[model samples]
Target: MSILYLVKKNDELISHCKCEESLVGDPGQLDCPWCGCGWLFSCTKCRKAFTFAEAKEIDKTWEELAREDLLGYSGKEPELEDINSWIDCMQNMVSHIEAGKTYIYLDGCFIPADEENFEFEGWKSKHNFYKTPQVIALKDKDIIDEVLSNPQYWEENIIQEQ
Candidate 1:
């Protein structure tokens, strides 16, 4: 019950160990049994070693199995959903808000709240990685001037106003 490793370059091609000799001894070992080669990861033709990130692992035992890259945020945060809902509420309020009324922008979200007393009330609040969101009045003259002058802000979802 030995597991064979292979690299598929294309639909028609598959590569195996270039040791040219049959794997010797027991199935589970760090080094290739036949050649006593510890570097099973070395490229056969080019002889270059691959880092873990560059190489793909295939389990021949389960040929149909799929691989997934589990990186970045999965959006499972409950607080994020609530925050988004609050953002939506604020977006809806924008149309009815008074012409001179001010709004607070906090960490990519806009809400009609007192900037000085505003806090993101959630489990994320206590985490050190989560910085206390800087409060900025969306109607500030300086902010308006900067946003108008800067092209970078135009490309980002800075203001998700409907």
Candidate 2:
């Protein structure tokens, strides 16, 4: 079954976004292919965008999930000191975020946990099926506005009917 997100306001459900594995194409991918919401949800009722900050109000566990996904991390768990270094790197990248550049989540996974182990016979074949990390880029502001205004996006049949 797909993961279904419920958007609520005043304790009432207002809208939902279901992350279907088939539609998502990649299990490890962060964004919803159908809506491109990327963990953010736009309520069909009040039109409010549900963000990670808001998610914290509903469930505190979302804080960790947000950190790991947005800040990026290596495939294998890092040591305490390594974590501090990675945090510094991520912070620096955050300051330099800009338009037209692709930001990849989980990009560090390309490096195997143990390079030597990967050289063993059949190891590559065993792990080759892993889903690739996902990426998102901010285009020019005017171009973004133009795409947002496209009527076809909001058409009833743009995504397959559930």
Candidate 3:
């Protein structure tokens, strides 16, 4: 489902933007249609939009945490520290996306999480399918506008190679 939010300046609605709830949940950020500046995502603590620099830092932290979680120990059962680090990394990544500092592009059609079978069936056989991640240049204001105008463009243009 898509929701339109009015962009206001001086208490007047200048323009509006559409957000896909499935892609970005509530409290997620979307680029304003009138102005290129992003106004949707903000830090819960500071209420300020996340910068690219902050996103990079968080990404580095997440990588470090993931390394520690995966490679630091040689034990069968995961240690509390390992699990905690993984959780922290996930939280940081989510927060970074929520702040609109980074965007995730899935190179495939959307599949509802509730669906039981995600694989594709062909010739009496089932094949596992995974959505590939593509890096997008969110710095381009025009790209943002285009994406907002037509959310399906991404899926149509970029299809995952089987």
lDDT of each: 0.26, 0.26, 0.29
Q: Which lDDT value does model 3 have at 119?
A: 55
TM-score of 2: 0.20
Provide backbone clash counts, one per model: 0, 0, 1
Highest-scoring model, lDDT: 3
**Candidate 3 lDDT, 1-162, residue by residue in tens:** 221211111111112222211122112223221122222322222233221211222223433344433442332455667657555644543542322233321211122222333454322122343421111223344544454234454334332557
Q: Scored by Cα lDDT, where does model 3 land? A: 0.29
Candidate 2 per-residue C-alpha lDDT over 1-162 given as tens digits, one digit per residue, 9 for 90 to 100? 212222221211212333221011111223222243322233322233322111111232322323443333334444556545544543332343332222221211222211232311121111221221121112233422232223342242233334
Q: Of the candidates shown, which would achieve the greatest TM-score relative to the real structure?
A: 3
TM, every model? 0.17, 0.20, 0.23
Predicted structure 3, TM vs. truth:
0.23
